[model samples]
Target: MSAPSVPPQSDGGQSGRPGRKPGPISDGVGPTHRAWLEPLRTRFLAGGLTISDLSERSGWAKSKISELLRGAGLYPRWEITHGLLQVLEIPTWPMRRLWMAAALEAHKKPDWIDGCIQKVALTTGPVEPPLEHQAFTDLNRDAYTAYARVFLEDQEAFEAVQETFDLLWLHWHEALASSDVVAFAWPVLRERVMDRAYHSEDGHPELTHAAFNTLALSHLTDDDARFRQIAESLALFRAISRLPAPQLDVMVLTHLLGLDHAAVADVLGTPIAAVHSTDRYARKSLTTVLGPQHDPGDAPA
Candidate 1:
């Protein structure tokens, strides 16, 4: 079935009410909130599962799930969000926050206050100025290493890696909309692609593309080992993408493009001490999300 229609913006005209808001809900916040919620709802429904099915998987009551979906009554607690996220197998905090924000907004209308909410929602967690730079570089390096491990395992697993790359690519675009770090990393990404292609002995463009396709398709595989690896890579990328601007710069320079700490410091006009600190903090933060074992030291330095 086609998805339900979302509210559309109205042309600047009175809709038979004096100074009333133009849409179904006059509150300025409704449209923004609904916009976010509807997409998530559609995604859930598209999974071809019912609320009861979700409840069973998430261990939430069917009624609660329905209420959350309907955007009616009390806001869902983090436990509910966490439970549903577990059932969905979603691993990224940015994705979780995105959904949570949508769910929260569902019950309210957009207003001046929402601006602050959006800012907080989009901002990365606090990082000390000293540790901002190296953290991102380590993150990218770690991500690539993880990606390589997964890609090398099997052609099928390679597809899952590619799928993650596509998600990262899309997410990178989104990050660019809010920050320049992505823009800076684009060429680095291009270089990495070329490097991989050049290093491959097959030299067949189609086969190379197939290899990437293999990684992208990895998300579909049921193999436990491959599934976990792909999930891990995606989660890392998600965390890096959500990093605030300074850390993002470090990530692009150090990880995506493979610059050294000194180079990153020079580029950012920051001290090496600060760079080291940033790297440490970024790594620690990422480890918390990506798991301690997936530390940067574990990846190709």
Candidate 2:
């Protein structure tokens, strides 16, 4: 069967304009949509490609393309989305995951999503992951999993790591060209972890839940001492979570995961000097909140 045709024009003329704004996306799939749409938009704009250009290249109507660009109308099928992605020169494999995630959020069943892929004849035969990509995953997966587990449960943390590797596999070429693979991959891992993290009112990841699981709390046996330690640890963990991203990352690697500054620099793909500076900033920030007596240096150990 042929691919689905464009449905009725839904965006009026608002979307086809040169000065484009993203249109409303379905609430359930909004995050996944932006994950796919934002990169696609950046490439589209960078190439100076028009809806007409995309229509001619991708064989979709300008109206449909506009709606897709603005994220208006129905959650689109993978077939059309894939076509536009090709025209925009976005990597398809990584995007396939994002589209599938959005489709699931939009309540599409796994079998139904698979059927859509089959209908479009888009399935490529199974292939092995690149050796270098596999090597990277093998080396970093455990440490990354440990890092993610600070905020996530085991299964969630494992899935977050798996998703990060899948993304690295998809963009392995671009990642290789980057200054450091860790530098390229770390943010992606963080994004996946944070997506599942419990956020506070101010939008930082909430560590209260994770704080109770810390080894420091687990070792204290006396009820009164445990209670006091819990109070202290909670305050420190909350402060650690609220630090700016760079500082927070350094703190987590250095204190919680037991990585030294040199190791953290390697893991973060940052210079040792920068990691040291960020770690110092994090300590000062924590001290400012919990008092000098409640130094995070004592807690995570």
Candidate 3:
């Protein structure tokens, strides 16, 4: 929570890559985290909370707070970071959610995460920004939001859509030759969100440090009443986002996006039976999360 002691001359002692070191800086703060928190640091300083003041308020040992902000090769605790957000007096729950997501995503690569952040951050513009990225968001933006909305918050959802468009942008010629942008792009978009939502480097959580554990951000519980209400309510957006990462891809593809079981399987690169099982589990989990209002059978199970 301590404000970064960044002088005007430097980008907080990190002109380009914030926590980057010589020769790749193994486990350093990636671009996504730096992009996400740099603004917070600026606002924190603007609010007149000096580094010492934030350190005092966070009540975290100076070392812990520094580690959190510097964010060198750590997954970051929801409890600790959320506490700092509270102390910093950052406005809005969405921003907190963004921080939570970026922190979580930051544990991996920065390129995609930072790209998604930029996309969501630029909401309320172009349907699809042109090829040069000079104007307009792009036509495929809607498709990303529609599918990605399942795995991400509203803001992140939009960014996910943009990421999908980024794929479309990359493979424009291939898609043209394939004569099916849907087939070509959907698989890429679907897997991108899925891998980011779940799977770590080895399809399992990697131990970053002994003292701290990587807390998976998905899964709903009684403790999530506020967010759960958002899940339960008619807000289709929140409902999808609240589901566990695995369930989200299946449910969103099979239900919300109107893809059939086989199509879901294709997008997931799994068998038809696996898709059905995932779909059933997702609906059942929704029933539990929604508790009475939702009927698992209402889904294709």
Candidate 4:
């Protein structure tokens, strides 16, 4: 019998079919695949989940998951890819786009690394701290109020506060990375970086010294009002972070640590008057800085 007839293929160049996968002349596949897969693997490992566990949750086969993780597979099908993301509980929008871009690049010869490579390429070195520290201090105070509100009550108002924080966080990081304070430098410098460090280490003598040094190096010079607000917020965060297990429980439960004035007073062996007064002051201060419109009485703490 005659051999089976084969369909003719088009070759743009003087070579094999144009549409066919290219040979060595085409981009090598290894690096292209690695670019996309490496970050996924890193993130998965960082999440502390096993591949098998991920497979069970995502409803993907072990081999396919492995292949995807290995960058052996470049196709970005939503079913499989999004399933993995759902299992991981990562926000899907940006991550999905990142993966899809990698997959498309991998399909071509001379494949390129993933989007992270481009991001890194665009990034310059570490950014210098902002010149006006007051801006950052103000931002920190705002962030603290927003964060505190979320901690206090699980209400729609708190949800709005959380969304605001999310935007601020992105803006802050961009400012830090780009050294561009005009945009969102205040929040990034004061709240996200400096204030947390100050409070967390303020109680620690060694760390406190280092924190001051960082403040100096970052050139964080601010006005007294802004500085005081940052200091107060840090104190609050520190108090919350260092509360004894019982008091913490009570504060969270009643306020966030739980317990109303009487309950907190009984637990701490303090008078209800003291508990109530302290709570009132804290709430008032928070509201005053966050927004005068916010009601201290309605707040959880």
Candidate 3 ranges beyond 4 A from true positions: 1-145, 149-242, 296-301
Q: What would the per-residue lDDT of candidate 1 be over residues 60-133, giving only the tens digit for each residue?
A: 88877776666565545556655654554333343444444444455434453344344433223222212433
Please state the error at residue 256 of candidate 4 in Å.
56
- Give candidate 2's error at residue 124 in angstroms: 7.8
Encode model 2's per-residue lDDT on 1-301: one tens digit a residue.
Answer: 1111112222323354464544554454454555566556656665655678788889998888888877777878888888887666556776777778767766789998897777665444225568898888888888899889988889778767876776666567777877888888889888878877889999999888767877877778899999998888788888899898889888888888888899889888899999888988888888788778977776563
Stretches of candidate 4 exceeding 4 Å from the true structure: 1-36, 73-76, 108-301
**Per-model RMSD to reference:** 20.0, 7.0, 16.9, 20.7
lDDT digits (tens) for residues 249-281 of candidate 4: 333335533346775554444567866666666
Of 1 and 2, which scores higher on lDDT?
2
lDDT of 4: 0.41
lDDT agreement with native, every candidate: 0.46, 0.75, 0.50, 0.41
* Candidate 2 segments whose C-alpha is farther than 4 A from its true place: 1-30, 123-129
Residue 85 lDDT in candidate 2 = 71
Model 1 regions lying over 4 Å from their true place = 1-36, 99-301
1 versus 3: better lDDT goes to = 3
